[model samples]
Target: MMIKNTAIIDIGSNSIKTFVIDQEEKYSKIVGFDKSMSNGFDGNKINNFDTFVDSIKNSINKAQKQSSSKVKNIILITPTSKNKNHLISEVIELNGAQIEDNHLRQLNKSMIIKYKTKLTHCFKSHYVIDNKIITDSPIGINCGSLSLNAIATIISDEEIKLFKNIFSKIGLNLIFIYDSSIIYYLYLKSLNLHKKNIVFIDIGSSTTKILTIKDEKISLLKTLPIGSMNITNDLMTLNISKDFAEKIKTKNIDLILNDHSSVEIPVWEELGKNQKQTKSYEFIQSIVTARVDEIFKLVLSSIPKSKFFYSYLVTGGGSMQLNLIPYVKSKFGIELELVEPKQVKGIPTFWNNPSIMLPFCLNSLIENGYIDKFNLFKKNDSFSNKIWYKRFVDLL
Candidate 1:
């Protein structure tokens, strides 16, 4: 048997995580994992590009060393802080009853031209036929010319340039660049959630991404900028130190603090509760609960009500909150489940906890050949036509 190693690096607003796995036909436990927090690129321009690149490179380098495997191919999931919107287009065309590569190419060409976008990856796009849903690549089957419907998750060109520059600095070729939400969809597929109408939620430090899968294909997606970090900020503003605020935020106390408390906050704490309890456990919970509720509301409004399904499958560092799961369930009237990324095949079982290892599962899915990439654009005519190329060479 041959041993293959695949590495996936997810760069997000909160932290940068790397997952390295040994790949066979079926992925096994994770072999290597690395995570670095406090990159601090949220809600502001990333000024230290060099430091950021070094941070990304160091994560992969550390994972490779710990996992003791050589990487063959790298799948990159880029940051989605700039914008999140749905770009939908419907095309009705007829090319006889037989569909082949030419038809696909022609349709892809026209789409790229009209949208002014380019294809960089290959992913599944489904269409509604008759009353049932069908995938586009149903070749050698009987059908009309075709009515194609597509919903694309697009990241701006400015973001792509940032990604290219980061990868270029590390001297690694970017085989594919996909939104983190797509990577999450690939992760969901590994868990058998892809076949059903599932809402997969990735609650990170700075943003929460909601991706909807209906009829086994991506149907809708929405992202919220608020995340677990907001809870910390809430505590910090109450004049509590970072260390103590984090502790109080997670600790469960019998005392119930209301939304409107007159607790005065101090810069630091004296180990135990003082007379002036500026930040009470109840207060923190209220703030967290309210913000999380607002986040979910925003997500709910963006997607169709029918797509909510039974519940939301949640993951990411924020999922660790014990109160969050129950709160979300009762408030939204939806079942909530946390994704254990380590349990997935291809990811090493050494670190199976979701508190900090959610990205590892995403990495494993990409390595195990479960994730699909969408090509945003086709190669333009200038690249294929020799005459245009020759003219450009002469000018150079």
Candidate 2:
């Protein structure tokens, strides 16, 4: 059945974002968009369950209101960790000149077989292959072997349950669970400008999601523990309030200071000290720049340059760093582009604005029926199909 209006909720380490959309056979209409600070789930940690659940409900309600329609299906995308071993193995084999269509299929089957314990809904596999990466089904090429590097992520069942339970409590029908990275990648694809080798670094508040897309498919997916919170932690170590530290971090303004230049550093009351003087930008920038540099270098290493692919895209909250883009370009000497979600069609003009663009695009895809296209995998019948499996195994 063609569901009318669809809604998508993306729960990230930094925010809870929602999108509502409707599409006919010919056209798609984005009706609503909303997001709220719900960094309840940060990386593998859940700080406050109550606050997270409440924030989710509020975001969904706002989306429903803006759309002026009941949410037919809600696709929840969470950053629960995924296993990347299978994809890595596939890349290794391909690089070893042992890859074929059958090999790819075997890898896919093995992924499901291994992670069936965690998977809960229909899904799709997107391969981001560097030039070194080889496939048996090469469109039109004759080469000895392909040395490819890949990153694959498997969404977890428990993560889906968290969103489903939240929706159930809020009186909404849960649709399919999605990979937030996948959703965001599709948003980039819709732009049609990023059809080359590109990596998207979504540096959120507490966690950074590194994704590489090549040949219009996901090549690598990784979630790192480092994020903007590290800068806050650095400030907190100086005994400063989290709020004040956040302000300074965001401003990113460096004031020229002589030897007389000094900034107040908070000292703990237990230590019986009010404030200590220190140079403002020198110390903080050293910590922040070092962390940010490590992240960029790590992302660069993940992209195999031998593959002849060279396009990097930066986004998310940490990208708000004023000098980050230029600094990355100057430091890495690789061409990097900032992704603009407002460039896509059917996206409302308001959402085209800063910061909200990525989530807004993701929310619209879910609210519309586009998310339904992702439910391509059929339910498994392992019990009844045991004989077929056995026969297949015998052939192998």
Best by lDDT: 1
* Per-residue lDDT of model 2, residues 231-322, tens digit only: 77887777677777776666643322223334565555676767665765566667677777877776766676542365777777676665
RMSD per model, one decimal:
6.2, 8.3
Candidate 2, poorest ten consecutive residues by summed lDDT: 375-384
- Full-model lDDT for every candidate: 0.60, 0.59
- Which ten-residue region of model 1 has the weakest summed lDDT? 375-384
| TM-score versus the correct structure, for each prediction | 0.71, 0.66
How far off is residue 130 in model 2, in Å? 18
Question: On residues 23-85, what C-alpha lDDT tens digit does candidate 1 reach at each position?
Answer: 566545556677765263663357577777778888888778876666644566666654454
Please, what's the RMSD in Å of model 2?
Answer: 8.3
| Candidate 2, superposed: residue stretches over 4 Å from native | 1-6, 22-27, 65-67, 70-72, 83-154, 188-195, 214-217, 238-243, 254-279, 304-309, 343-358, 361-375, 378-396
